[model samples]
Target: MADSTPLLSDSESDKPPEPKRPPRSLDETIERCIGGFGWLQIFQAILVSLAWVFDAQQTFISVFTDAEPSWHCADESVCSSFSNICQLPKGSWSWDWPAHTSIISEWGHQCSTSFITGLPASSFFMGCLVGGLVLATLADSTLGRKNMLLFSCLTMSLSSIFTVFSPNIWIYSALRFMNGFGRATVGTCALVLSTELVGKRWRGQVGVIGFFCFTLGFLSLPVMAYVNRSSSWRTLYLWISVPTILYCILVHFLIPESPRWLFVKGRKEEAVTTLKGLAQTASALTMSFSNVLIEQESLDDNVDIYSSIRILLNKRWAAHRLTAVMVTGFGIGMVYYGMPLGLGNLSVNLYLGVTLNALSELPASLITFFLIGKINRKDSILGFTILSGVCSVLCVVMGRVWPSLQIAMELISFFSACTAFNMTLIYTLELFPTCVRNSALSMVRQALVFGGVFSPLLVAAGRKNNLISFGVFGMAIGICGLPLIGLPETKGGVICDTMDEEEHRQTEKGSAAIPTLA
Candidate 1:
């Protein structure tokens, strides 16, 4: 209070000269990022795409493995001794217990061997649930995206190979769990990496591209399954792991650490060097390295892990968090996991069902790409969730009245549900600001894993009671979309770079009144 003006003037005079700021307009940032790292970004995208493809291949292998018929000898000793011998007649082996003469009959033999073989499948998602939530937070703060990707790739590849040699189901499941933990690391790290490389304008598109690669993985699984159909299941695991291991080697030499993470950690020189390397790889001639200094934004002094959690749970984001949990949990849990298990109960061609389901994801992703720019995200999500729920309810009706239409109903429901699943992935990324983006995303992913955990159990329970499981699932899916009504529309909206800006915008829109940064 005493001579405050003089003291302020003196402090201002003594302060070090401020560094020049780079351009911050949305368009300029987008243009600079595209102009600088466009081609290399595409390469990075492809590598990430392959990683996801392998992940899907690993997940759905159980379906194809179960579809293949197995031979059980009458003599226990013969069965035990000759199990590794590949002498069964081509296409005659059936893993279904109490084999049925009519493959198309509604009461056709359930492939119990696949269930037994795949019992360990849940372990992977369990590992993913734990690892993604806990280890993923370090991706931004300590390890950085590049090293995380490299480590995940190495771990998953080695584990996949180890799974192939698993002496029994118990050993195999344990190995698969390890593989899943590594895969989760890849999923979270890759998304964080891609988003960090671009400015706010391209975050949605890049996130879509990241999920798109996962669908590509689904597509690749069928080809891999078909190729290894004659070989032992262990051989199939080995073949899939090989290419991923090779890619890991390539990642070490090619990918750079995320520049955004570098800037945030006060490693300005490293960030500039990495950006320049990307520009060189992209052959960008117009980029001015000297003009690309990272501009530091003032953040709250109390920033910590707990503060980030509070930010995501604040009044402004509560609806978004709720929508993410409900939609992702129910959509993927019911549709993606439920359909395959249910179909296996009714038919021997579980691979056919899985392939059809995977195929549906392609159109879903394409639709998301086309409509994400055209439609409001909230509306699109609600529309697709409603469509999927209706389709699921229809399946229940079709299964009862016209049992012959069960396959058709399943295929249709899968198509609609997959669209919702893909959109959930895209929309969740769009909902949060950058300051706590990874944390918020990890929270949503944890919900997805929670949902995934319940899917197999629900499908198994549904096999005993017709329509009960699906009706409950449909209700859950439809009800989840109700929260979308409260979420702000984010389609084509530029992502906010910091919490303060997000709060300011929310206040301007009369949504909420959060504290702004100094």
Candidate 2:
């Protein structure tokens, strides 16, 4: 306490205060550099989105290419697809379509082996589950967004092309697994990269593009399948494979590395170059800073990079968010992937049924975009999931009475599930820190695949009892959404760039009281 106010000399007192590290925010710098969303940025985003297109394509292609075609029995004694051959004349019991065109007819899996027919579809999801878990950290660590995308795209393309050479169902299923494994990182990396390429103002818009692309890819399946209806199922695989390979090559040549990633990696010069290229492409003003930077590097550059899962788990609040999000995603995944596959059991028009289901995506996307802006994500997801569950029960109730009405109910169910799925995509991006965003999303995707893993089996049993099939789907979606109600409204929260920032922001958010109008 001695001479508390008399310590500073004249020279020391005159020294200018050391500038408070310029509010050093890396996320702010990235948004500033990206500026307003431009046409050039849109082009890049579109090109990168090819990954999303093929991801959707490969996922649902089995609905047509692997379907069990309609068949009549040779005789009451001889069985076929849902028909007793013994009840019909010998020559009248032939397949309605050529055997070579479908996996079911071609392999004689129609009657006796029908129960296990779901193995291949289940196998694909299993592969996705394994691959997503194994490769979840790759994008966040070494491959970065562009390279991870290129790798996933190439792997999926090559695997699909090789599927054309499968000798039997065993070989075909193996190839499908490989294909699923290869494509595992595509959507996660593509989504993360696309959002990262833009500023906050355009993030929601950029996010919307992914849903549209996925819907387009889903829609393309029916068209491609319709065109190849007379052709062998192998043609469908080859159809998607060849074009996919060419597109991947184009993607390799076009898309740029995410500059934010470069900056975080201490590659500031490269980051500057990427920013410059973006500016030049858009014909916009270049950044004019000779001294301080936007604080791109992390505060602890000396610390070794940790896996996203580890980082997420280390923080209590982050761990809580991760658990809730992944669980909800799992439930949504079951309905989203399982409903369409289960629709094969519908007695209505198969082609028309799929077409209607694909069309449901458009409304889902539009609705999700509109609702996400108005209310919070938590409510939207919760509402849509419960609706999907209700519709699932409705599908069973109407299934036996009116097949058309049943199919109509099923369509609504798919539509609701699809909306919930879309919400999960954007909602996930908002939950985690940017440093490990890709990995976190990938982990959640694996959780989704885990749920998808069991759906094929459910669909297989669906024909026997609609209750068991749709009931599980209903319960899964409805129950999982309960935990999400506790999460705060993240409608206007900024995407946190680092663990420290996310923790601090969440702390502030927890302590702050909601304002009430008098």
Candidate 3:
């Protein structure tokens, strides 16, 4: 035994010295540096969240621009105002509004097929889908969140400028596609960057800031469109696009890169500098970043832009979590995006109905903002989705008898959806670690947008039958939440910074037989 002791000691010494574990983890260190959600952090988070305002503007702008205008009988003897515009002779009816007020009136597509009318909206969504697939990993790999966000807003605004000059519907549709492509990364980047800039304690609330800004944007459109009711759709585009260009410039100069992202990318010096700039006190800035080493696996700056996505797919647990969240997001998105667009089906005035729905988002965002720390992500998603679906279905059932009740039900449905949408995004952020958080969130957003791709068609079809759009929205959100049962609850769990760290946590939890909260 005495002779063998030397060999054991030698073997122990031969093993590489375990990297000195920091007294505090990177998350804890970051939390310490940010000084418990300082005002500076709040200001930055709100600044980034403002991007959602423009995003929401671009998103729902078509609701007004492509609207089917109110038509009047040019010759009342031949046709009434209620006459089917498609069946009437060209000179028999004319638009009540100016020809340039809406694309439908401007381009003489008032009587065009639904396919033609919905084409631009659908093309826009397709651009979002393709753009998400292509740009999802760029934020995680090369550009970082701020740069990617800046690029997206720049592209979106520039394309909108070009859209002002579109001579035909085809050109307008193509430009709308470019706008969607550029806008695809805006919400995701903003959400991730805003949340990442703050401590975990404030992440949920910070994330909801974007939702509030989005509601503001949604509300702004009705006002903008109404004020410009007699003006050309091109003017509305200019109003939205020009300010967005100025916003991109502000973002470029004002926003800093996410420190967490920098740390993951092996840029410690920059990460430290960012944290220092964000720190409210000189003492907090004094904490040494030297010991805040990332896991060896995460330090590989040579990782390809697509590596984060591949990692998500290759890992069975991540794949399952991703699949479940994405499936659930698809349902929430269908109602969230579809409801407002389908509001034209309600008996309320289009602008009033849209304004009411947009207003509903305010309460939804507020609820999430206040209860974020206490809300259970899975339960909230499930409950709100179920409620949204029931109300949507009830809208179809009760709409014919009481239009007021139908709009109320629609508002309730949208409110629930907005809350669920907020939670879904926050939930997605919690499920993944820093290394792949952007990619995972991007994929989930793609799922959301993918659902929206079908919304215009459903809204168009619902023009004739209420059951198609509202009913489908009800069924999809209600049923899609079941897969969440298989995913682990992320509430109160510290977010990890690397894939290996996350996997280790899962393994330890599994070994300890920890039960997940519903």
Question: What is the lDDT of every predicted structure here?
Answer: 0.63, 0.78, 0.87
The candidate that achieves the highest TM-score relative to the unseen native structure: 3
lDDT of 3: 0.87
Q: TM-scores of the models, in the given order? A: 0.79, 0.90, 0.93
- Report the CA-based lDDT of candidate 1 relative to the real structure: 0.63
> Which regions of candidate 3 deviate over 4 angstroms?
1-24, 291-298, 511-518
Worst 10 residues of 1 by lDDT: 100-109
Model with the higher TM-score, candidate 2 or 3: 3
lDDT of 2 by residue, 12-33 (tens): 9999999655244655765566
| Residue-by-residue lDDT tens digits, candidate 1, 1-518 | 57655645777899998975533633244446455447777787566546666667766665554342544555454454554424433343334333221121112223334355446767877877777766655554556678878788788889988876665556766887788788776766677777667755556667677667777777777677666565566677777789888988877787778766565555656766776666633434456555555444433223353455665556445445545555655555566666765676554365576677777778777887666667777676677777777777777787778877777767776676677766666676666665566666666666666666666666667766646667666766777667667566666666665655565666667753223322
| Per-model tally of clashing residue pairs | 5, 7, 0
Best-first order by lDDT: 3, 2, 1
User: How would you order the candidates by TM-score, starting with the best?
Assistant: 3, 2, 1
Best by lDDT: 3
